[model samples]
Structure formats: C-alpha cells, structure tokens
Target: MDDRSEGVIEPLPIRRLQESLINRIAAGEIIHRPASALKELLENCLDAGATSIRVTVKDGGLKLLQIQDNGCGIRRADLPILAERFTTSKLSTFSDLTRITTYGFRGEALASMSHVAHLSVVTKTKTETCAWKAHYLDGVLVAPKPGQTVEPKPCAGNDGTTIIIEDLFYNTPTRLSALRSPSEEYARILDVITKYAVHNPKVAFAGSPLPDLSTSSSSETSHAIRLLYGHSIAKDLLHSTFSSKKQDEAMEEESEVDDRESWKAEAHFTNANYQSKKMIFLLFINHRLVESSRMKRALEAVYSGVLPKGASPFIYLSLQINPRDVDVNVHPTKKEVHFLNEDGITDQISDTLQQALASQSHSRVFEYQTLLTGGIAEPEQSISKKRKGKERARDGDEDEDMENAETKTAASPPLKKTASQYKVRTSLQDRTLESMFPVINPTQIEGSSSGKGKPADISKSREIKESECYLTSVKTLRQNAIKGKHKQLTEILEKHTFVGIVDLNKCLSLIQHSTKLYLVNHGALAEELFYQLGLRQFGCFSRMKLQPPPPLRTLIEIAVELEETTAESGLTKPQIVDRIVETLVARREMLSEYFSFNITPTGLLESLPLLLRDYTPNLDKLPGLLMRLGPQVDWNSEKECFETFLRELAYFYVPGPLCSANPETEDQEAQDKAEKWQIQHVVFPALRRYVVAPKTLLDRDVVQIASLPDLYKVFERC
Candidate 1:
C-alpha cells in the first residue's frame, strides 16, 4: 500500500466481510431492539393462527424474551433447518411473492435473531407424539453444551410452539448501544402488543405486568376499543366501513377487476366530543401495524374545522389491500409502508370523519345561568376577561391552567345571556335555494295525504327470519352497503332540514343542513335507498296484500303489450310473456316465504313485498317488473338470483319522472303534487331511517349547491 498518512489518497486492498460479520449486519437491520424482535415473533404467532398468546420479558427483553402461542406448530422433520435463511413454508416460487398472505415469508426472522442472540425453539405438532427442542446460532443448529450432539432433542411440551430469545444483540455491541433504556424498551414492547391486541381482538393476549397488561378474546371491535382506549373514547366513537366501488361492481358483474387497485378500510374515530392534546392514531395495513405520516396528517387536518385548535382525536384504522399492490419488503422492520391509491383512500377517509364530526356538532348543549337578584351581576371587566380566556382556548392555547382560571371566573357573579344570543338561527329568506327556485313547500305538504300506517307497524312487519339472517350471500351484500356508505351524504339526509322542491320535472329538491344547502335527485336517491333496503331486509319483507290476486298470464300479456310499445327486445311478445310466467310459477314458494310475494298455486300474482310505506309501486310498471323477472334474474345461483331480483324490484318502485301534463289540469296537478309530497315525507324519511347513502349517489344523486359561509364571503366582497 502507498503511504496513506501523507495526506495523499490511496486505495486499500478489497476484502469480503466475514460470513458472521455479514450475518450480524443483516440481523441489525431486522432486529433493531427488543421491541422489533417481539414484533416479528408476534407476527409469526398470529400467522400460525394462534388464538391465545403469552409473552414474557426480562430486562426489557435485552436479557430474555419469550413468546408462547397455542397455534399450529412446526413439524419435527423441519427442525434441522429451522433457523436457515431463505427457508420458509409460507412461499415456494418467486411468483408466490405477489400473493403472500402469511406474516413470515423471507425465512430470515429466526435466522437474523440467531446471528444476534441466543435462539431456541420448542415445537410440537398435533400429530407428533412428543415435542422437539432445538438451539440455533449463526443460522445453524448448535449443541446445548460441549460434547453434546448438534441435533434437536425430544422434550415434553404442549401442542404448540414456544420460542425463546436471550441476550439480544449480544454479538452486535453497536446495535445494543443504540437501544433505549430498559423501561423505555419495555413500554415500546407493551405498545406493540396493545396495538396488535386491538387489531386481532379475537385473539387472547397475556403479557407480564399481569394486572396491567392482559386482554381476553372479543368479537366486537367497538367492545375491544372500549376496553383498550377507555370509556371516554368509546362513548364518543363513530364507526364507518368503506370499500372500492370497483369491488362492489365486480361482485355484481361477476367479473375480475384489477386486484392491485381494490381495497377496503374500517375506521373507529372519536367525534367532536372527545379531544386530546395529541393524536393517538393506530394504522394497520393488511393487519400489519404500519405508519404513514401522510395519512396521519391528512386525518389531523380533517378535525381542524371541528375541534378547537391544538386539540386532537383518537383514530384506529385497519386497511386491507391486495398484496400485489403493497411492497411489504421495502423495509426490514415493515413499520413504514406504502400502497396504491393511498392519496385517494386517505382523502376518502378524511372526508368521512369530517362529516361525522360535522353532524355531531349540530347537536349543541345549552348551559343556563341565573343572575344575582336586585340587578347585581358580573362586572364588565370580569366578563371581558372571561371572553378573552375563551378566545385563547379557541385560538389553540388551551391549557389546564387556563381552564382552571376560567373555572375560577365562573364562581364570580354570573352573567345572564339571552337564549337567542346562543342559538344558531338562520335567516332562511336571506339565502336559500328554495327562495331562488321555489315550488310547493315541503313542510306545508307534510301529512297532506294519509300515507301508510305508522312506522312502528311497518317495523314490526319487517321481522327477519333467523335462518335467512345468517346466510353468507345476504351478509356479504349487506356488508357491501355498509362498506360503500358515503358519510357526508348520509349526514345530510339524516339531519337535513327539508327546504322545498326545486324542479318537479327534473325530480330535484333542496335541503339544508347546518349552513350548507344541497340539491338532491329524489329519483336516483330513492332507487338507491330501496336497493340498500332490499339487501338490508332480505328474507324479511312486509307484504302489500292485493285485494284480489291478478292472473299471472294477464299481467304478462299487459307487460308484453307495453314492451312492444316501448322498444323491441330479443324475444317476441308472446315468447317473453311465457318465459316470465313460467319462471315466477317455478319459484313461487321462494317468493312467498322470503320476499312475502304470496303467489297462488294457480299461477296468479298475489301480494308483493312492502319495501317502503306510504309509497306504492305504480301498477303501470308492475307489468314490466313481472315481465323482466324471468330473463333479468339469474335463477341459477342463489346469490345472483337474490341480487338481480332485488335490483329489479328497486327499479320498479322508483317513481317515473314528473308528468309533463299541463299544471292547470286538476288531475295532473294533483298527481304531481302527490308525488312531490311523497318524496319529502315518505322517501326522505325512509332514507333517514335506513339509507346510509353509498358512494354511488355522491355526485350523481346529491350535489352541494350553496353554503351559508360562502354566501357571507361573497356579500362581504361586494
């Protein structure tokens, strides 16, 4: 070598790192500390389908960390290469990487730990007569003591696996030095366990500090959140489930979509009522605890409009995406992750939380105070100070001391304020869509016609059959509705103050919620509302009994005449009628029992399912519904049959567009007004009661027309 000490650059001889050194470096990347190692072990336990897990730690797991799980155990034959790198049962070929479902696939977790610490495993498969215990070091099996055989030894154990790690980072002093203190490490380990417990609430988790850390198996996610986060958060929690519309369409079309782009998410977040100094966010992508600052920041911004400045909300979100769209191999620890459509997904979730918060904010609690007698009241200066203190709180300087100061001020002479000063009243005439495009007032037409009986009787009639409630296909459809609900529109419909009909011809109406106005397409929303209701009340329908059963053949003939008048079909009129009559007569029992469509044995139409009260399916369209029930419904498959049948029923129930008949004509005017009244009183109320407003209706059915705040800004500029 040249004289390198003389300030002249010189190259040193190249040499490969020792195999042990190489392994130690790689191990450092995987197992940063005790917490990282515990995460890997926990994932392995969950992957094995363990329902109960017990974790033990000593000296914050630097000295010892043990995890025992009652899951499928490794076979004795596979013990020889248990710690070998690149050996795994989860994956086989390179292509398998695209669809890895299990927690461990690289086969490096155990090997990495072996290089940095003492690793031992005691595993017993159900078929095995005895358990096998093995010790590993540097990715190879090793003897327990000097002169002993370097092979696994049969031992007494339970029917699961138990892994023990000792002296973590023993061979890597640099990695060991980078670790936190024992107490801090223990806290980190506890946090990891806590989040995993929340995600997999059905799995029992038992960890040390027994009284402080233990969770029993639970089925309800809300119940689990209550147990872990406390009563405050749980009480204020709002739940929502959502998925890609592509997935919904795929189920209907029975066609494959790009799997890499499909995803679903479930979120439990605190409403405006619950607030904290810092956000407590737990995100699980594909059930693996991961972090995304972009998502966390986006969610935080959503709460800014609802919560006072400097306050945060608690959120727990679990996301499931196609494995092909995710690159879990990007990081050794797998804590930080990225996925396709992240921005879109984040925006959707944020919008959902924003609406939930907005709706909750509408219900305000009023505080009443009595002033002193004889005109004695709080000093003006005191009132001024109190107002300034609230201003600070609103400005984000909310602290305990300030709260205490405010409390102290409250003890002084109380201030008496009028309820009008506190009430949030809107001058409707000043800025309302109804004022611009006026039609019959929604409130004036309320109870204009004797609609169907009370909702209580309707609910009683819609009793679900216990047998049908548990059907897999029906549950999936119901879940799709829940997962596809659009939160903002749902809030609008649920709490909106009905404005008035905007255009009877277009079938559009206006409704106000808080300070914003929305134009709702009553026709489209009613169709979607009925569709969701069909799925929601599957196998349980209240019948709308016809006075006398009409002959099926007669209705079919009527439908044939109508079809011939409307447009040409693939089949002739007579052929279409025969097909529809034969199909209905074949499935009469199914129709009568599940859908409440009681058909007589003589092939005559009878009662129909009462989907919505106070609203009737126009008999004009009944023939069409009856005619298409044969060709449109997929009678071959149970799921498809129910889906297509419900769709046809929903379409039939949606009223036709408003009549172009002259408004001056008495009969036509009465019909148009009756339809408008039904929209406001029957359709909208039913929507508030049952419809979750799925994403399909977001822009198409409901559109925001004007906002009160925006109007004020415009006025100010003028």
Candidate 2:
C-alpha cells in the first residue's frame, strides 16, 4: 500500500447552518428574481383588499422595488413577527389550509425577501390615527440607522400599506448574476401587472412614466382587454363560458358533501384572422395567476391546423375550480400548479376554443370586396368555361345563341349603342346558378336551341316534406334526452295559467296552476319553446320576405373576405372563397325549403325564417349565417347536417331583450313595462302551449317549489 493510503481517513463533523445562511437558502427558492419579489408584494396588496395598486422600480428592481396600496393595512402589533416563517393570518390550524381562498399564505414571502434584500413597511389601519413604520432583516425587525430603535415607530401616512424592497438577491451573488438587464426585469413586472389587471379589472394600476390602467367597477372582460392589450385584440376576441356537471345521478348523489366538484371556465381568445409570431397565454385558476405547460400545449395544438406555420394566437382563460381540487403548493413560489382531471379539462377547454374560433371565423365580414359589380366576372367566367368545355366534350352540346350566332347576327336589327348594350351576360345549364346570378335579355335564336336543355326558372319553389325534416344525430339524441328529463316541468307548464309579469328586467313571470303559485324563468321557457317550434316546423318555416332583398353577391363577398383574412397555406384565398360560394349556391334549394332562405341565383336574398311576426331576423348577421353554412353544417350526412342546421335556426330565433337606448329615462321605463305586458299575455302563453320546459331553470328546480317552504318558514319567524 502507498504511504498516503496508510493515513486513516477522518469523519467530518455535522453542524447546524447559521440562521442567516439558512434564511438565505430559503430566500433563493422564493425570491428568484426582482419580478418574483414584486409579484409577492402585489399579492400581499391585493389580499389586503386594495382597490388601487402602485408600483415603482429602479434599475429593473435590482436597486429598488416599491409597492403601495390603499387597502386595510397591517396591525402595528403584528409587525414584530410579520416576517417570521409560517406566520399568517390566512390560516391557523392544518385543516384551514384546505379552505384557503386568499392569495398570500404561509407568511414566507416577506421573510424570504427580508433575507435576500432590505425590506421595510409603512402601514396604517383605519382604526389607527397615525402610521407605523418598521424595517426588517433575516426575519427580525431591525433599526433603520445605528442609533434607531428596532421596533415599529409612529409615522404620518394614509390608511393603507406600503412595502419597499431594495437590493434584491444581494446576499446571493449567483442569483443576482443570473438576472437579465433592468429593462427586461421591468418588462416582466409590467407583464404581471397587466395580467392581474385583466383578472381584476375593477382595481386600478399605475406605474409612473407608464400609461395608467383603470376600468369601471362594472366593466367587462372586453373592457380590460381594450384598456391593457389594445383595441385590435379587443375587436377580434371571441368569448364563451363552459361548465362540467356530473352526468351520472349516482355520482352526483355520492358527492353531495363536497358538491364543489363542478367547475366553470371562461375564455377570451383571438380569432384565426388575428395571428402573432408567438402564442400569448394567460391562465388563472381560482383567480390565482399560474402557469400550466400542459394546458398551454393543449391549447396551442388546437390552433395548429387553423393558423399558418409559425403563427399563433392570444388566449386568456380563467377557471373557477374548487380549492380542494387544485394543488397550489407544488412549488415554493407557487408559479406552477397541479390540478385534478388535468387532461380532461384541458381537452374540453381546447375543444370549446376551437368551436368558438370556427364560429367567429365564419362570422367575420370582409368589407373590402365589392359584392356584384366588381371582380365577380373572373370566378363566373372560370366556372362557366369549365362547365361548357366539359359539356361539349361529352355530348357536343352548345348554347342556342352560340350555335346560331351567324343566323341571329344576319337576321337581327342593329343593336342600340347604349352603355347597357355592352354589359356582359352569363348563362348556366339550370336554375341553380341562375338563381344566384340572373341574366338580361338577348337576341332569340331558333335552330341553335339545344333540345336536351330545360328553361331555367329562378322563381320556382321547392318544398321539403315532413319525412325529410325529422333527421336526428347522436348530438340531437343527447339534447332530446336532456329536454325529456323535464317531463314534470312540461306538465306543470301545460296546466299553468299565466298570471302576470313579476320582474321584467330579469324575465321572471308569475303563474298559477293546481292551487300553487310559482315563479317562472320566461327566458328559459322561451328558449325551450323556440327549439321545439323549430323541430315541429323544420321544413316549412314561415317566411319574412325582405322588400328589395339585398344582393346575394354581398353575402358571398363577405364570406370570401373572411376566408382571405384567415388564409392558410395549400389553398389560395380566392379558391377558398369560390368553394364556399359554390357550396352555398348548390344547397340553395335545401336552404330555401327548410330554413326559409329564398335566395335568387342572381345574388338576391328573397326571404328568411319568420319565427315571430313582429320580430325580424337581423339582416346584418345574414352574411355571417351564409359564411358559416359552408363549414359548421355537416354536408356528408343528411341527418347530421339537418340536425345541426335546425339547432342553429332555433338559437337564432331565441328572443332577445327589448332594445332601450336610454333605459334610465321614464319614457323608456314605461315602454319597457308595456313590452313586458305584451310578452306576458301574448308570448308567454303561446310559448307555454307549444314549447317544452327545461328540467332545470338556471340550475334551480324548475317545477318543484322546494324553496317555497323555506320562504314560508322565514315569514313565520318574521
């Protein structure tokens, strides 16, 4: 053996880490960057019920980071141990963790910041006459100067909280070195504030030298998007709400104790026409901003087929799930979260987004294209040439005018040299194209006529029989089942007598039947009725004829414009538009007979479905309807296509709120009351007689008065 090997190896002694060193190690996990520290401070401000939050930064927060909020401030007595680990007002016992609804818990954020940076707080609660200020370091209150006391001192301030952090990650050279430039860090800070502003639009946010962000207390999500993201995004955004309920009654009954299993997801996403180089994803779970790579990837996959290569979309999704179903403690910083039914929820959200995108894309109006007079000849000429060439090749058939051109020119008088004489005319073999595009008179030719051809009649009506109307698909079956479950409500509706209108604003009505008083949701009843009416009158819907019907070319042009805006590779924009126009033109007979769309071959909309005699279908949305017909309707299977078409028709016929430009005015109010009376006497009774009632109205009991007993009991106590 070597002499060095002969020496005995000594065991190293075990020792506890110094308090400062231990704190620094913990700080590394929580305060990874200046943005991370700022996020924690912002969360604290929000938890204090701050309505206004102000942030200040210097050198990308590496030198200075400060946040002030006008909210209920911290108690002076709590300052001493405010930075202590695991000290929090949000939770007390272990069981309280499961029901935590606030953002900042564990009380580790401030403690971690104190260890890595200089931390100070100035706060004044409503009860306090003066503010109390304190400095902290390593989880303990510290003196600001050499001779100052190590305790909170009374100071002048507003009734809110202000937290200041300086020299973030000062104790960790490696972490400090890992950070990017100050401007980059500030960018990150702005991004966090932007997302939070979107989530809590009621709260105002300001950072000096940067534009202030604020919204009305009652502002919607779209308002926030317009204020923060810009009008471009707001204009193109499509919104939807999704919910999941237990399909099996047994499963629902077994989980009655924790009935919070249901979840709702809301999404605001850009359409296919709106594209970016990279996807912008904002995800909030239970109002907490979090990152889920799995969800991001799933959503991104949905847009892959819709967008061109390297193009992406902006998506903002907020999910309200039960606290018990989410694991918010997976990371120290809580930047990433894990949740139950991740894959299933992700798929549902993705599918919903895809459908919304398709619908939105099909509804876009391309304002640039001229409907009839301009650029219309190119597509028609191309189609006519192809048809003519094919017909001649197959049967040597030619138009009468073409075959007798010499004889007609020799026999006919000299044509008038007017501007109209130079106008070009197009001819088709049958009424399909003629209905979409009509032709003007021309010189008659006798011998050149093709005996095999029939005269094109654009005004002829085609009828769809009742047997052709009752088409059902899997989706239709499921919908019917859901509607059928409300048998008890349907019976009640059949027997009920319309009493009067209770709340016009809420569409609530009062009805009496079988010696019982009941409150009804007239809006829900109207929807159910409209759907049933659509099924019963599927093939021969009443028609609302438009006077001087709008040009069909206008609708086709709008569809073409939408397709061009959302153009992709492999198919040119014009080609896509042509395909859509062709499909709609081909289905003209089916559309007219079943949906009451009497469109002329020369691009004229003759009529539409008249669900209500006084209510006219919004013509502005007609282009969108025509555009969607080519994509959303299933043409491969007649049953599926008809089912989808009827569903869309029913949705279109659902009653809309009466228009009130100045609802606050007395005249408007009076008008609204009159309208309500009309609906109560005329609409409600009609609906009750014909429409089926849904089992649940707004997720409440539809027919049964279970809550009525509780009301009576409360009245007795009163």
Candidate 3:
C-alpha cells in the first residue's frame, strides 16, 4: 500500500489483483474461441514453411485443442520466454510492422491464449539433436507439480512445433456456455478449411472431428462426409497457380481487384461440386485471409444468373500484403482485419468476372434432350428386355429426388429369384471408360402429328417417304431373320439392326465398334462430328452456307434424320400451300445471324410466318410444322427454350455459310455472305411459345438412374 492519506492525495502502490484482472480481460480479446486460437497457431506453423499440419479438437474446443506442424521449431533456450507477453522472433520494433511478411508479428497470440487456457509446446529445431518442451499458465512458466523446473527439458521430437490448449476459459462460465455443439463447431471448422483450401491448393491440409480416421468409431462412419467435402476442405492440397492480380486506385486512395481479372485456378471447390451442394471459391490476394463482403456478394451475384435459384456458394479469400496497410489491432482475436483498400479490390474482382463469362460464346449449358434410337452391340434381347421391364417397375415410372434416393448401406440384401428370370442390367460395352461419365439427358421428340396422336405400331411409326431414304432397315430387316426352333439370338439382332437410337425420352442404346462406341441416332448424329472453327468449336452441325448451286450441311442434317431415327419409320413429308406462307412472312432477322433452321408445324405454320410456310411446301406439311409443346425443360422453367425459339427459329431456314471444319476461317467468310441465306426456311417451327405455369425445378423428375444401385440390381438381375 503506497497510498498516503493526509491533507494531499498521494499515489498508491500497484495492487497484484489489478494486474491479474487486466491480464484476464486481455485474454478475452485474443482467445475468443477455439477456432481463433487454432487459426493463429496454424498461421504461425505455416509461416514456418510447414509441409503438413494436423489439428484435433474436443467438445467444441471446450475440452481440448492440439496442432502440430512440420516446420521450424523453437529452441530449448527460447522456451523460458516462449509464452511471455511482447516476446517474438518476428518483428523487433514498430517500424518493422509496416514491412511485415510473416503471418504473426504482434507477439500477442501466444501470451493472450496462455492467459485463459492450459498451454504446452513440444518443439525441436534442426540445430539441436534433442527436442525441447515447455508448459505455461497466465503467460508464465509454471512449476510442474510444485517442484519441477519451469525451463525447457531435453526431449525427443522431429523438426517441428506442436501446440496444445485445454480447458479454454476454465474459469469463465459465459464463454464456455457460448460455444456451440461439437458437430456445429466441426462444421465451422470445415467451413474455415474450405475457404483456405480453395485459396491454398498446394498446401496439404487435413483435419477430422475425431483425432484420426483410422481410430474413429463405427458410429462416426455414419456421419462420414462425402469425399468431395474432405477434398474441398483444406486438408490435402498440392500445388496450384492463380492468375490473380491487384489494381491500385489513386482516387480516394483506394485500390481494388475487379472481376475483370482473368483467373484459371483449379480449386477444390470446382471438384467438390460433384459431392457437396455448397461450392466454394477462394481468392488469396496475399497470405492473410481477410473478410470481404464485396467478394462474397460478387460470387453470389455471379452465381445468381447461373445456378438454380435459391442456392448460395461458399468462399474464402486470402490476400497477402505488407502488415502496415492492415490494422491487425482492430480485433481482439485478430481473426479479422481492416484493409486499407477493400473497395478498390472489390471492383477489380467483379469486373474480371464479367469479362470472363462474356468471352465464352457457346457455353452449351442448354441443349435439346432426347434419346437416340440405335442397335446395341451384341444385344441380349430377352435379358435386356427383362431388365428394362424391372427398372421401369421399380421406378414406378415417376420422377423422384436424387439426394434422398442414394442410400449408404454397406451391403444390400440379396433377392431370391430363379436363374431363368434373372438378367444383367448393363452391357459389357457400357462399362467402358467413356461410359464412366454421366450421359446428358436428351430432349423430347415430337412425331409429325398436329394433335396428340394415338400410339402406333411398327408400320405406322415408319412414317417416311421412299424418295428420302432408300436405306430403311425395317424394309430390309425381315429377310435377315432366321427361323429356329429355339429362341434365336440372331432373329432378335436381325429385327433391330441399327447401331443406336435416341428416342423421345432421351434413351440410348450405344453399340460397340472396335475400341470406340457408335451412338446411331436418326437425327443430329451425323452433325455431331468434330470440325475445327475459330476459337469456337463446331461439331456435327455444319456452319457454312450454300446458295448458288449446291448445298452441303443442310443436306447432311436432313439425310441423317432419315437414315438413323426412322430406318424403320419414314421421314415427315413437306407441306404445300401453308408452308410457303411461313417462309414469305419472315426474312429479315435470319439474314443477320446467318444460321440455318427447319420447322415441322402442326397447325397453320403457313399463317404464322411466310418464311416458315415456304419450307413446308405442302398443305399437309403445314400442320406438321405448327409448334407443339412437349415436356418443359424443368430446369429454367423453359426460359432457354423460349430464347432458342425466338433467336434461332423465328425466321425461315436460309443456309448460312456451310460450316467447314475450319469454323474460325469460315466464320469470316460466312458472315459476309449471311445475307444470301436469311429467312430461307424455319428449322423447328412446331415448338409452341405459350405455357401455363411452366414446371419449376422442384417439379423436375430429378432422376439419377445410377444413384439407385440396389434398385438397379433388381433390373440387372431380372
């Protein structure tokens, strides 16, 4: 007590209680949560150039925390000052903070964390043959059990640093109660990893709610996340390059990175899309993981126009900069910082993104969907028929959710059935490498009927003209059939000799042809061949135009439709009077885009547009050309469909520049001559524009045939 109480006031001696109280308050600021402490310790390990990092947590970090890194370790001589306040090997003075390069420089994380928790460090540097270890409490070395040395002891360890924190805020009830459940905390931990993982793809980062996966209980397997979740997590990163650059703004003394910045980072978030719904994108301006609501909002905004509505994305951005511009003193925990030029950076990021998307001219996210009809290689007709029947029965011929559909049961029960009744679901050809990728869904196909026509038999389904296709397999198939006493496999093959088919519902029967498989569809199959064009790639569909005397690409699309789809069924006949009206009505816009199109209208296609009417040529063909609405796209409420109709089919088909294999060179030539083919013919005029409450995404079938392996077995072993 240095206080003197006489006539004048005198200074009092500093009380020990006051010093202890101040230390505890400071502890609250630095070690806000288990994650905060973990982050700080992790950064220190990384700054040491550690190749591997391991983290373990318990009871949402109320019980224990541990982190080990294979980086430079503290020396035994430094152990006494290891947990002391204001002691660090990073920066020595105030000016050093400006050009700071390492992750930690304030020298407060260790001291502050030590004040509220039991802390320990087991470390070994390359200089000493032996390792060193220490323990601390209230930022000071503690005597082990009352009589042990407070200094480090020689111990065995690798060249690394290991930190442990236990009973965080043991004396603070409010802080302990404020922590979330173990599972919830783990989610937050994974969330943090996801952001960092996206940014630091080369750094292998792994963490588990349990200490180790091998030691996890069987019950824990029930909660085992998808492989995508773990990969997207910052656990097993390798090397990755990012073309991210920062721009400075002299105005307002602010600098920002706009979306215009070109970036091609192969991140875990992109791969994680296959496993998890929440996809993440990371940006590292430098090394610090700063929070930029602008970056986050930009990501969400870009995704808003692309992904299904109502879905959000996850991201973590790390910006490395000299510490001077960053005010690390802003937050007690220091998990966040105030950057000097946040606004400037946001603008650059957003601008870069806008340019990137605009440059991708043909994104192909939307296309027609329909199964092609084709003969499969070595068709096991009886067995395949049986399996198909079982598949239909199990699915109940209705749309279902894909998520709830895939179960993770280790083994499925066996079914009891006679051998004669069994069948294999997939063919040997289907197990090929190319088949491993999922097949795109085909669009609905419309038959040549203005009204909903009745189901037809083999003969009626063959609605084509003899002049169009002399190669109808149906006309020549019966002769190849063999008459045998037993059910002959040859007989079945002879009946359906085409290689593959893309039907209305988008089904495919791929055929084996040497190492490569051929998908023989009646339409578009001939047009899908690879042809090199400028930077834009043009497949099967021809991109060139022909007018003076000969036409090439249009004839190919026309010929293939008759050859594949209706080898048994004939092609639709052209309509007469009404057809002329369609072509004559519209001609202007088609000339500018220089694209080809055809229409098979059902009603008065001729009345709708003169340009379309001209293509039909026959009175009956007019009805066939009238638009018909089949199933909606069900993904975008058919917006793309409507856009396609307006942009491509509104005008009559005028052959544009015949798309040569060289599209880049041909594009220039074709554009100059585009005026020659404008409004020549309507490509697919029968697609109706109006709809009543088009199907929402929820209304979609969401069918994932491969998702139900067990259920598929019923069909496989029919």
Could you say which candidate leads in lDDT? 1
Candidate 2 per-residue lDDT over residues 1-718, each given as its tens digit: 6655989766789999998888888888898888888888888888888766778888988998999887789998899999888889998877776767888778899999999889999999978999999999999999999998998999987668999999887777888888899889888888888888888876667664243343433356777887677644776788898878656889878865344567889999988777789888999998888999999999999988888889888899999888878777788998877778889889998998988877766543433211110111122233345544544454444444445674555668864221211233222222221134343442222212245433222112222222343445534644663556556566667666565666666666666544345666676576566656566566667888888888766776675675433332234656656766777778889888777878778667788776543333335556666665665555756765775566556555544343335677765655554455445444565555565655434232133232222333345456
lDDT of 1 by residue, 1-718 (tens): 5566777976789999998888877887888889889999999999887877889899999999999886788988888888888889988898887777777788889999999899999998877898999999999999999999989999887667999999998877877898889999998898888888889987778765432455655346887777666555786899988776554765859866566688888999998777899899999998989999999999999988777889999999999999988877777788877678889988988887787778776653332221111111223344456555544455444454545576555458864332211223444234444346565533333344235421222223333332358878888777777887767667767766667787877778877666566777787788887887777667788888887888988987976785432222234677767867887988999988778887788987779998876677667677778876875565756876787789889988886542266778766666776676577567776776677776655534566666543454356456
Assess every candidate by TM-score: 0.50, 0.50, 0.45
Model 3 Cα lDDT, one tens digit per residue, 401-491: 5425657465876433322223333352334332244634522223323344321222322221212223333222211211211132112
Question: How far in Å is the alpha carbon of 67 misplaced in model 3?
Answer: 1.1
Candidate 2 ranges beyond 4 A from true positions: 1-11, 212-218, 246-260, 362-718
Best-to-worst order by lDDT is 1, 2, 3
The RMSD of every model to the true structure, in order and in angstroms, is: 19.3, 27.5, 27.0
C-alpha lDDT score of every prediction, in listed order = 0.75, 0.68, 0.44
RMSD of 3: 27.0
lDDT head-to-head 2 vs 3, winner:
2
